[model samples]
Target: MAISFYKYQGTGNDFVMVDNRKLAFPASDESFIKRLCDRRIGIGADGLILLQDHADYDFEMVYFNADGRLGSMCGNGARCTVRFARALGVIEDVACFLAADGEHQASVERDLIQLKMNEVKGVEQIGEDYFLNTGSPHYIRFVDDVENLDVYEEGRAIRYNDRFKAEGTNVNFVQRLSDSEVFVRTYERGVEDETLSCGTGVTAAALVAGMLGMQSPIKVKTLGGNLEVAFEQVDEGFKSIYLIGPAKQVFTGSVSL
Candidate 1:
């Protein structure tokens, strides 16, 4: 069957989107979904997203990793879905939806998207790295120079290490460039390699640094582009955390799967 799909990217993290409002698409076949995300012979993407109907929100975002397993909330994927929703008239300029993590809010203004991520409690410092879940689980560590570091080598060690072996976590290497600016490199688990960008990874990285005494409105530079995370910190947790960057439509087409 030919599946109508739309491709979109938030920074460099790309996704193949399908409007599955009728829920007619097969959601149970892992191999089928996995093959659809294959770069060599399929409509390549970091993930696949289904825009389904929601009872109380604009729409529902169902995310599947490249491995064909349903995953926790994906920030870049969410932004792409929001933009897709707007293009489909599910929303006009603003939208809210329920993800695996919980409720999320986003707005589209002039092609750029500002997504409000879930509140992060804080980062737990274990040894040298900080652990936190910003919609998705991430391990944030600061290094001297992030650009030169071997992200795939070092990140794989920490991700596959015995401590996080059951379900590996995404790893991020961050280097603070200034009080409010930092460079980030990530080793994503689903893609299982270093992509040009990662939204949840950056969100976790910024929150971890902010909790550790860095300032808010943090600027994060990724291989794809720059993203800004702004928030207010309180004794309870980090609130009003906003992930802002460009979420653009790459192309739209139908693929036979």
Candidate 2:
């Protein structure tokens, strides 16, 4: 069977999105999905997402990492999924969708998307590093010399360490350029390497700094481009956090898998 797909990108983290509301796609096919995400062999993307019908929410977002493993919520994927939902008439201008983590509120404006991430209770400090879950797991650590650090090697080591050996985690090396402005570099798990940008990783990094008392409305600069993270911390935890930026549609075409 042939499946129709669309291509979308949030920053440089790209994805292949499919409309599965008909439930015709075989989401359980690991090798099939993996082959679709292969850059050299098939349709190139950092991951794949399926938009399915939901009972309560606007739609359901089923995500798979590049490795073809069913993964947790992806911020960028969620954003693009919102756009796909809109294009498919699954949602209106604004709507809520269910992800692996939970329900999320989203909106679309042209190519830009604003996605509401998961609630963060607080940031756990381990020495100078911080850990938090922004939909997906991320380890945010600040380094004095961001320019000199070998991000791929260092992040790979941390990701594969015993702390997260079984299922590796994404690692973000952050450098505070200012109280509200920061630079972020992330080593993503599914990609198994450095990505131009990671929405959840940067969100965790900035919010971890905020929980550490940086400031609200943190500006994070990633290798791909600049993004802004805004939120308010309540007694229960940090709520009303919005991951705002452009989720560009790089290009679209057909490819065999």
Candidate 3:
């Protein structure tokens, strides 16, 4: 069988995208998906995304890490999926879709995408770091020299630590650049290494930084590119959270399986 796929990247976090609305792709074939995301021999992406039919929303986003396991709500992946949906004519400028984290809303203009994230009830402060779930678990720590930090070594330590070993977690090493900007590096759990960028990780980083007195619409710089996070803090929790970035199609091809 020859499966047609599209490649997309948001802030350097790339994905192999499939329009599976007709349910043609085999969702249970873990090895096949893993091979497609393998950097050495396959499509070479950080993850894979499926745009499927949804009864209540514009579409359903099924995401998988490079390891072939179902992953949590991937911020960048979702943004890419939304753009994919738009290219497929499933949506116009604004859209609402279903993901592993639940329903999410998004808007696309040109190559830029703005996604509405879930509300965060609280942020846990562990030692000097902060732990939060912005549709995905993230461990955030502020550092001084982010440019030279060993993200893989340091992030792996906390990601696989006994405290978070059960489910594991994405790790972010951040350095404050200004009141509204910061530099972030991430080690994603499912990817199991340092990635060029991480959407959920940055969202958590920005939120934690905001809680620490940074302003809304925080700008985050990553190795891949830059992203912005904006939110409104309510009395009970945080709301109107948005993750903004660029998601562009890299290429498209057919792979024989």
Candidate 4:
């Protein structure tokens, strides 16, 4: 069978998108999904996203990592899915969708998407580094020179370390440029590599910045592009967190299954 798919990207983190509202795709085939995300002979993406029908929301976002395993909530994927929903006339400018992490709200304007993330109750301090979950688990480390760092090597070390090796964690190195700006690079767990950018990782970094006394609406610089994270600090947690960035459809094509 042949399946039609859409390619979308948000800050260089690309995904293969499928409109599976009618349940046409074989979502249970992990190896097939892995092959579809292969760089050499497949669609070549960091992940795959399925936009399916949801009774309670605009749509349901089903995400899988490049490795073909069911992944946790993906912020960038959710943003791109929101745009896809709009293109499919499933939603207008505003939308509410169901994801692995639960319900999320979003607004789309042209190519820019503003996605609301879940509230974080607390941040755990592991030595000098910080760990938090912004719809996904992330380890945030403050660094001096982020641009010159070997993200792959260092991030791999931390990700595979004794403490986090079992259930992998996304690693992020953050360099604060100013009180309101930061540069971040991430090693995502599912992809198991240093991606151009990571939405959940960026959100984790921004919330850590808030904990360090930086204000809200932090500007984030990544290898792919720029993104913004805005939030309101509440009692011992954060609320109204939004990850703002651009998600664009690259192309559409049909592939044999």
Best by lDDT: 4
- How do the residues 111-175 of candidate 3 rate in per-residue lDDT, one tens digit apiece? 68999999999888899999899999999999999999999999999988999989999999999
lDDT of 2 by residue, 40-148 (tens): 9889898999999999988999999999989888887888888888878888789898999999998887757888887888677778787888888899889987777
Candidate 2 vs candidate 4, lDDT winner = 4
What ranges in model 3 sit over 4 Å off?
none
Q: After superposition, how far is residue 11 of candidate 4 from its true place, in Å?
A: 0.8
The residue pairs that clash in candidate 1, if any, are none
Collision pairs in model 4: none
Q: Model 4 reaches what TM-score against the true structure?
A: 0.98
Q: Which model is ahead, 2 or 4, in terms of TM-score? A: 4
How high is the lDDT of residue 6 in model 2?
A: 91
How far residue 146's Cα lies from its native spot in candidate 4, in Å, is 0.7
Stretches of candidate 1 exceeding 4 Å from the true structure = none
Q: Each model's number of backbone clashes?
A: 0, 0, 0, 0
Clashing pairs in 3: none
Error of 3 at 250 (Å): 0.3
Candidate 4: list runs displaced more than 4 Å: none
- When 1 and 3 are scored with TM-score, the better candidate is 3
Lowest lDDT 10-residue stretch of candidate 3: 230-239
Cα misplacement distance, residue 222 of candidate 1 (Å): 0.4
